[model samples]
Target: MMVAVDSTEKSCLSADGEDFFYFGYGSNLLRERLQIMNPSAVLVSVGCLKGYKLAFGLFKGQENHWGGGVATIFPSPEDDVWGIIWHLKAADRQSLDEQESVKHGIYSPIEVKVEQEDAGEVMCLTYQMNCFNYSLTSPLYKEVMCTGAKQNGLPAEYIKKLNAIRTNNYNEITPFTMQVRDILQHLQINTSE
Candidate 1:
């Protein structure tokens, strides 16, 4: 789907480009993966979205599969989630949609209110987890929450809450799981234990 860019951000671009704002929370939060996924994407800023928590959804099975947590859209009066925003050209969004599995309904876009670093506010299209395929069995789930905790300055209580999540005892490596492992290595956390 095409997202219309606000008139305010248009001047920042070089031409009459159809820009699409995407809010990324999971592995997409890691710049390396984003670079691999969309090399042309411009980093707009770091931002936050209220009323969601990251969790693994859109599952294929317990093994030889993976999924990532996305902001689950819901009504909340006092919750906010942090993430990165990217301004992508509409032409490149088709590949992103495919990478994100949009048509299969594994992901659906939503217009979210986001706080920009310098621009203040922007309406962006972001994806939410399918929820139908969520399971928290892997230790990587905790690793991801810990990564978010370290990167986003999330509260320790939040990390504790994340650690408390119930999963189905899964033992397969998803890309998301690999990401957490990478994050640990990046942080110089020993995995030898």
Candidate 2:
């Protein structure tokens, strides 16, 4: 249950003109990476998407790729999905989509309403996990999930919650992510449940 924190000016406007709100449930939560790519991007808020379960169902055949688990969007009235909301330009958003491989049957763009610190209600682009591209047996699964969970500066307690799950492994968790986590921890940014 990590909460999105804003570190920019008071006004919630996209300077690049094509600025849009992106719901980052996983990898896109990493601020260091995002800031490097899009300096104008700002974290807005966070909330749970109910009804979907996190699982690996998209890449059942690709063994060479990381065995990463994706957040599957399903009809769940009781389950709550946790994530962050980021505002970025259209071009930077494209970079995010490319990094996440959103078109690989792993993710699908959907419309969502996000809460902002000052503006309140706002429409944004949220992606649901593409169950079609999930891989259940990949070795880098857990680490990859953790990487995303921790990327938003989630607290250690929440990160521990994510680490508690060992259904899969993420041996391919990049060194860059590890470094980002370390730096975020040092900065004391909390993205926890």
Candidate 3:
């Protein structure tokens, strides 16, 4: 799952030669979620992605999970998507890409400008769904988004929008999905979300 990076961004690597910035507009907005796979992930800032809107239309191909869509960004001149900026070791980039399903061609990384307080703007890699067919969202997935949004302290209005989103009550048929539900329950999560 090699991602062909243009020579331009290759110049932005950190001095240690293993750090890169990422703009998280989706579930990865949750530092904890990203940390699950990449422990070195650090939240550098929070900001809005201008000229883009959050969309839950990217279908997940993973089996025995939510039969709904995940988050991605779409062009919208009138909107801004609130998200977090993360810095991780460059060594974990491929693992992060795999987590986002880059090998399956589900998402592709691209450089985008994010506006953060004090920092003004920073160029970082973000994932965008290449799938065109829009779909519904799963309730559990929505819970993750809402929890993540609140954890990052996004705008009140944006958080409300995320909470208000409708989701499909995707039944747990696969053992993995069921176990996920069990874990959420054990943790006293808001499954109704």
Candidate 4:
């Protein structure tokens, strides 16, 4: 049901100096987080990936609190994954690849057709869980996803779905959780979301 919004620069340079796009549905929904990692990244639009459902799972062998499940897409004809489209300089590919842990094989980038609110359909790369995780999300991690969704103005129904995701119940703040706090602070996003 997404319709078009006003357009912005829609260019993303890949590793081979070719422009491409990235669809972010997880923590990357926080523009600040992606900006911090890839300065050239720009918001293309809020969009949805059809035929897929969002799920969280752990990356096999990753240790500690981060070992908790991260966001991923699973094929489901009845589902549409809401997310943001990002355009980046082709040269920024390596940095994004590293930041995304693509080097570690924890996630794999796959091409998908994301329907922008106002822009129709466009093919963009989105990461999917390639390794197994604990299948649980931490409280702080859930906060990150919910806050990002609210900050970006994603649909209220979808935001509620994000909020309803059950967590592992650990709420103690840790150095790792601080990363979410930092992004929230940087973007001035309300945790109340």
Q: Number of the top candidate by lDDT?
A: 4
Per-residue lDDT of candidate 1, residues 1-193 (tens digit): 2233362532322223566777776556554455566766666776677776555544343232343333344446677666777778766676677666777766666677787655577766677645445544355544554565455444556556655766555556667667656766775554344
- What's the TM-score of every candidate structure? 0.63, 0.61, 0.80, 0.84
Best-to-worst lDDT order: 4, 3, 1, 2
Could you give the C-alpha RMSD of every candidate to the true structure, in order shown?
6.3, 6.8, 6.2, 4.3
lDDT of 4 by residue, 14-80 (tens): 3677756888998888777777778887777889888998988877746545436778888999999
Best by TM-score: 4
Give the residue spans of candidate 1 off by over 4 A. 1-17, 53-55, 58-64, 67-71, 131-134, 141-193
Model 4: residue 145 alpha-carbon error in angstroms:
1.3
Backbone clash pairs for candidate 1 read 136-167
lDDT of 3 by residue, 35-119 (tens): 7677787787777889998877754444325668888898899999988888778778878888877788888877788788555
In the range 1-193, model 2's lDDT, one tens digit per residue, is 2334443333333335466776665545555545655666677665455454544455444443444454445556665456667767666766666555676755666765555534455666666655365445343345544665665555566578667764555454566545655655644555442
Off by over 4 Å in 3: 1-17, 59-64, 173-193
What C-alpha lDDT values do all the predictions have? 0.58, 0.55, 0.73, 0.76
Scored against the true structure, residue 36 in model 3 reaches a CA lDDT of 67
